[model samples]
Target: MGAYMSEKKYTKDHEWVSIENEIATIGISNHAQESLGDIVFIELPSVGNSVKAKDEICVVESVKAASDIYAPIDGEIIEVNNNLENDAAIINQDAENDGWIFKMKISDSNQYSDLMSEDEYKQFLEQ
Candidate 1:
């Protein structure tokens, strides 16, 4: 998480994604995790599951409550982080990296245009 990395970009509901390639890494944002508190369990969609933008694809349970995690864009889930089943707290440790719940094979990267960039999201948080 040095200069080459980032922990930004946010959805209206507080999910985030960082795309380094054709694949987009997806997860809940720090704000969402903080609100939920002390994650205890996570239910992620199976790899290869097809999900559309805004579709509910996962759930995270924390000391406070259980919450649904939505797909940030239309795509097929390429990978699910098995680490959460054993160590769900990893999401609290690093929501952007180890906490990433899934990797999506976006059907159309252009759809990302509707999401907020890091700068915009940061501004959103301030409001």
Candidate 2:
């Protein structure tokens, strides 16, 4: 894909959030998709659905397992990646970019502080 452009915040659970103009784009990390193995299906939350921090907002099914994708912060979902319905394997191909799951209007800007920076997340993964 294109060069990495966003400053991403990551969770211990393997989700990532990238905010721009109060809209937080959410997706699973590459490490997560690699672990899931050959994603086959995705169930995304509907647009406008209210989600709390840590709520299960979507599901991804792969040949090896099914995993719940959690909301990184309180927000209302404003858009979802419909492309995943037809080709969930995109997640395995590019989990951080073209495979983003949803976009939300963040309810609390401060929640951004709770997530790890790219460097911190890398260290976390090492641990």
Q: For candidate 1, what is the total of clashing residue pairs?
A: 0
Worst 10 residues of 1 by lDDT: 1-10
Model 2 per-residue lDDT tens digits across residues 64-115: 8889999899999999999999999999999999999999999898898779
C-alpha TM-score for every candidate = 0.89, 0.94
Each prediction's Cα RMSD? Answer: 3.5, 3.6
lDDT of 1 by residue, 1-127 (tens): 3334333467997999877555788999888888889999999888989999989888999998999988888988999899899999999999977899998888887777778988898789899
Query: Which regions of candidate 1 are displaced past 4 Å?
Result: 1-8
lDDT of 1 at 38: 99
